[model samples]
Target: MRRKLAAGNWKMNGLVDDLSEIKALTEAHPDPDVDMLICAPATLIAQMAWARGTHALQIGGQTCHAERSGAHTGDISAPMLRDAGASHVLVGHSERRTDHGETDADVAGQAAAAHAAGLVAVICIGETLDQRESGHALTVITDQLRGSLPPGATAANTVIAYEPVWAIGTGKVPTTEQIGEVHGTLRATLRDLMKQAEGVRLLYGGSVKGSNAGEIFAVADVDGALVGGASLKAADFSPIVSALENA
Candidate 1:
């Protein structure tokens, strides 16, 4: 059976004072059936880890370095994230791709590093609005899927997210039919690439919230979501998590 995941990308948000929201989440939803995770800022990993309990509230890193230990002044390595209590690390988020100028090879190397350090690599891929408008969204995303994912990316150590660049934080979402189409393509690609290995869960992102998650998850090949803004608050995020339980 495929497990449904409800992951929260807190982005650069959250502070020491915001741990209360996590506390509420862990308390309100003890033992969430849906695979639950929160990718917080690097600075808060340790604190969140300390508070983590059997609720299965797994914590992940927003990003990690491709190099284990290098002169990259501002880079945090996968091992470092592991040491800081992260079980997973997000790679190739559009923000990183745009702001840091990361390429497919860079993301692949980062996923390799994450695997080397025993962490699940959450690989993100998406296309801009212009690409979608020009009817090139699938081509762009497929190209990224072909280039960014590395060898040895199995279901156990990796997850893929399709976050449309135009939809993220913009309160827009691809129609249900559109999501199914892309996800189905992604599934076929992954199956062929992996030579028929199963358990690789494909997640949809881009402005996912409680209101729209059920419909999104209903789409073929969509096993989960990588939620953005709504994740900042437990009230908004908890329902999305619950949505997965009955999805």
Candidate 2:
């Protein structure tokens, strides 16, 4: 069975003081039934990992460089994240794709690097508002799913997150039916591409919060969520985790 994952993308947010949130989370949900993870900014991965020591809380990087080591300036590598105690890394987040102009191939390379470093790659794919309006959402996401994923990606080292561009941080979310369609399609695509598809977890992201988390988790094939803004606090995030646990 696929394990449910409630992952938080702190995204460029959080300071040394913010680490307290992790303490509150672990204390509240110690031994949570669902897997818990917080993907903080590069600066905080090591500290967050340290704070989560011997706890069920997992720490991860928001992104990583495709090359193991190079003169890529500010880029952080997968091995570096692993060395800092990160067990996973998010690849191809929408902001990265939009801000850095990362193509699907670039994301694939990053995921491959994460795999080589023995870290799970939470690969992200999504459609823009324009595409959704044009009835091209499925086509766009399917293309991304095909291109962003690397060869040899298995359930153990790979996860897929679908976050609609328009919904992220916009307080807008795709209806449960829409989420189901996309997740189901993603599942089928994974099944066709890899033998370990059944074990792979599919997470829905985009304006996910405790208020809507239960309904979202109930959708078919939605193993969990890749939460943003709401993840920054324990009060807001813990209830979402509880929803997933009951789901």
What is the per-residue lDDT of model 2 for residues 67-91, given as tens digits with 9 covering 90 to 100?
Answer: 9998999999999999998999999
Query: Residues 1-247, candidate 1, lDDT per residue (tens digit)?
Result: 7788889999999999988889888877888788899999999999998876555888999899989998999889999999999999999999999999999999999999999999999999999999999999888888898888889888899999999999999999999999998998888788778863468889999989888888988898899999988988989999998888889
Where model 2 places Cα greater than 4 Å from the true spot, the runs are none
lDDT of 1: 0.90
TM-score of each: 0.98, 0.99
Query: For each candidate, what is the lDDT?
Result: 0.90, 0.95
lDDT of model 1, residue 152 = 84
lDDT of 1 at 129: 92
